[model samples]
Target: MSGSDDQSGLLVLGPLLRYVDETSASVWVETREPATVTVQRGTDSASARTFAVHGHHYALVELDGLQPGTTQAYTVAVDGATVWPEVASPFPAPVIATLERGRPLRLAFGSCRTSVSHDKRGNETHGVDAMRAWALEMAGQVQPADPDDPDLDPSRVPDLVLFLGDQVYADETTDAMRAFIESRRDIDQAPWTELKDYEEYAHLYALAWSDPANRWLLSTVPSAMIFDDHDIRDDWNTSQDWRRKMEATSWWHGRIVAGLASYWVYQHLGNMSPSQRAQDELYAQVLAHEGDDELDFGDLIDAFADRVDQQPQTYRWSYTRDFDTQARLVVVDSRAARQLDPDDRAMLDRDEAAWLDEQLRGDVDHLLVGTSLPFLLARGLHHLEAFSEALAQGAWGDRGARMGEKLRQTVDLEHWGAFQNSFQQLAHQTIDVAAGRRGRAPSTVTFLSGDVHHSYVSEAWPVEPGRHVESTILQAVCSPIRNPLSRNMRFATAVLSYGIAGPVGRLASRSTRVPDPPLDWHYAEGPWFDNNLACLQLDGPSLRMWWVTGEVHDGDHERPRLAKVASYALDADGNPPPREGTVSKLRRRLRPR
Candidate 1:
């Protein structure tokens, strides 16, 4: 129990804890061969047969009938022989943690991690991996907490880790990923360095998750994921012109199909609760079968992915969950469900937008909106994006439109701000939620997002509101848990997205038909470029957040230390959380009262 053997070849990857509720938890695994995968805790056990996708075997075992507000160490097995814990493991035992009714919730989240080496050179190039540092910190803990138990000590580990996007960079593959790609196909071809099919994706994931530290962390902590543009391609569905250009590529067809299909098998399957999975036709198909032979989903999944890509209306990627009466998490699908037509450009298609509207209501202690892309960028960046979108839609002239189109793709000027209509709709809906127009107002309405490589927190207030808003409206962004923007880009962001750019961008957008944003915001904390992970803790009627980064200590890059970068809290009356240390300190220091 106190040692770890670097085991290899027992299983392909994972014993990843994916879903947990009051009475059950879901465990996912990729097997070395077709076999029955089981999850066991003491005497109680749950098992499921493997399903093949393009020669790869996988299973999701749901362990039910668990006691609420309890934590128990769990083991994974292939055909009933323990494959996890590896006999001599240095890491502590992983646990099955179920939520108790009306208990507080704590979650860790961030996005944009690129898989690379963890040694000195890699750390120098990409900075320390926040996730790995977190895993090491967690590994030192003696026991996992019963997350909802008021009597138990707060564990450093979170109940769940919400991975916002770009979990694996299919577009920006690492050298090892590229070598894997070369082993599979011709390097001279189109989509050369990028992933081409599901087989390649399988290898990519193995590369990403096989790290002992991160993998151990994932096995212990449940995670929910959504994809971003880099998960498929950079600036995916950015505009009509961009779509056209990608469509013209010879490799785009296989790429998108494989991307979506692999995403389904690897990430989306465990996102649902038992009832939701039962409602899924494909899941039902896999489970309904009881033949002696294991089910092969290779062709079925590819076709399903293709169909979903062609007609996004056939399926809904967005999902929601409630933590008793404490919190509601609505994770929206920002990358897949977009309306890219010039006349009706929307970040989310009509159906997806409508579904999100329904989930945006208030009635809980805290309301959390999880979108892969930031809903509110820095004011300057938002205005600039709005102006670009208007110009691309022929606000200025044909020449200006062409220039705007080029600029949009060139600088990645696509976000909620670019889709002004969609942004306004959500802004108004958020105001309604805060004002109790839709439901009883919560203590806080927070948008949790990550897409840009830098992290920041912004405070928003409705412009010229007629009624008192009952909840704090805020945007908290934590980005690039590993990958970071270059130094030059960080400096540019500080200038262009923070200070002078706001007035200039607003002036530019005034020349177009883009309506004024209903809510206005200013930075409360950061534009910090550190590779960090963030957490949100819902404590009774109040909410708190903090960001942490991995710092190399004593030249030990492999076992970097965790360092806190920031902290903030939400209040009852919707006031901006005292600017970290309150304006009083800064006022006293700078203004000389």
Candidate 2:
């Protein structure tokens, strides 16, 4: 379908609005076949010939040179036939809303969602999908809210939505995904039920994004995403030994290549600005190709993914953006860019660390560092992980190291705390920025993250008592927009990580050369085990955040309403009022359900 005619057979997946700036935006889509895809954004328009990746057709149409602070409802066309909006879409018309200069930034962020049936049984098993509820609420499909507790700032709409990671779970496939897999290959083989190639990955992406509620949400709201372990597999790149085990597998090569290559096409391509995308060699190749016949990106992306896996330094996945002196966001690639060598263990390789160091400066009202893994985990968890890392790296001997590696993998002790070197580097850099060593300190230096399948906010200050730190340093985590941790996991998380931090720290230090953490913090709000989505708004010097979940109102499974779980605000002084005194107190009072 192209511009004016019926748009039935042209489009397959999307016209997803991604990467919006003051005067420009990009729309991404998948087509049924090769055709010229065009985006009509009010008066301005842009088009690009669809490029083939494997057997699938796709295009990224960059719409630029538009007015700032403008909101324009847009449409998609393929080969001169208009296909988007689907004649009579139930959702609101999708729009490309550019950022307004000097405006307060409102953003919603969370990670780790599973694509499954959103019916009564699904809601009962997995909790309701928070993103879907939000979308329904935004579209005004939900029932009335509590009059006393009306929606907060009803007029406010987020400018962006940052999906931290695991937008799809390759390892934990849903029944639909498995059925698709079984249709293609034998279900009894290695990597059975797991995604193995670009074609499977494509199906996964389609399933993940095709839900009507979420598809509408994605179309209207610009989003940026990073992949977590589950996006490829559980505990991906957790350690050198983990790598060795996976590399030795017969199916590792195809799995990694497909995972990364699909990630590049489906998730990573839309993350960067137009100028940034123009610099990418693969993207440049697509733009330069000239033909009526489809241009397949199969070989190029395959080789790229393979080479990038072998030599991570050849490509950079981390990205940073500033919002006109209001806030600066650094979305880090914590998974792929790792220094896994035993003696030189680091979560961030040297180059990645250097890039992060440069991005951690002050001057903006807020500094947001987005990572899939939480930087400031609970104190006891932090100490234990650090201790495990030391033990695994041979603090005692080879035999001890072998046992430690097993323990580490079993416990999933692979966050920042596990990589003491990189953890300390970030801690010190953040401390410097908070202490005004970078520039005038921002109001808050916040680490926005997800992966733990719980939502919480922890406030921290320099461990050195006399340090003159002005800015608030906090870790705000909202995980599992759909996936809720099992009851056993909740118990394990609360008991092991919430209490006994003092003993854990002492034991870790005694066992090996474990350096003290740079900051000490307490949970200001929660470790709520709810399927949730969280939003943060920057108002002048104060930053406010709230978490919301889907509530199945009176047996209305298909129409769950958005319900607030928690809310907190950092004052102009960048300090939250007394909330929870200790992590143990949180565990006792707000025990996970």
Quick one: best TM-score, which candidate?
2
Q: List TM-scores for all candidates, in order.
A: 0.94, 0.97
Candidate 2 yields a Cα-based lDDT of: 0.87
lDDT of 2 at 337: 94
Give the runs in model 1 whose Cα sits over 4 Å from its true position.
1-8, 141-154, 572-575, 580-593
Return the lDDT, model 2, position 334: 94
Q: Which runs in model 2 stand beyond 4 Å of their true positions?
A: 1-4, 147-154, 580-593
Top-lDDT structure, candidate number: 2
Clashing residue pairs in all predictions, respectively, total 4, 7
- Tens digits of per-residue lDDT, candidate 2, 277-347, equal 98898998887777777789899999999999989989998898889888999999999999999989999
| Error of model 1, residue 387, in angstroms | 0.7
Model 2 residue 1 lDDT score:
29
